[model samples]
Target: MGWLQSLFSPLKKLWFRLHSAPKKRRGIYILYEDVKSCPYEDVHVLWSILVESHTLRTKV
Candidate 1:
């Protein structure tokens, strides 16, 4: 049992390192199928919210 545990210790550390790493953070992406669906008024409201929230990146 001791020998088995010793042999697998390095593998356990590697597994933990691979699994516990932080993933890349992504920002919001809004897509509208119809171009005319989003009106000027609605875009103004969305812009205000994004500004207040400090949105990093937005793809529309």
Candidate 2:
């Protein structure tokens, strides 16, 4: 089980990168709202990236 985790650890970073915000903008950010604790940012980078990507696609 531990070996499996190690093998997939790098994927986490890649996933975050693929889902993170663009390097040129700041209006887009991932917001994480957790009632269990407090509203905070969790995937800001990822959210921004995704939103920008979608916007670009829609424009096409």
Weakest ten-residue segment in model 2 by summed lDDT: 28-37
| Runs in model 2 lying further than 4 Å from the true structure | 25-60
lDDT of 2 by residue, 1-60 (tens): 999999999999999999998675344332323222444455555655777897998799
Model 1: how far is 51 from its true place, Å?
Answer: 29
Clashes of 2: 5
lDDT of 1 by residue, 16-57 (tens): 988996865444334322323666777767766765575444
* lDDT (Cα) of model 2: 0.65
Model 2, residue 54: C-alpha shift (Å): 30
Highest TM-score among the candidates is held by which one? Answer: 2
* TM-score of model 1 (CA atoms): 0.35
Candidate 1, residue 25: how far the Cα is off, in Å: 11
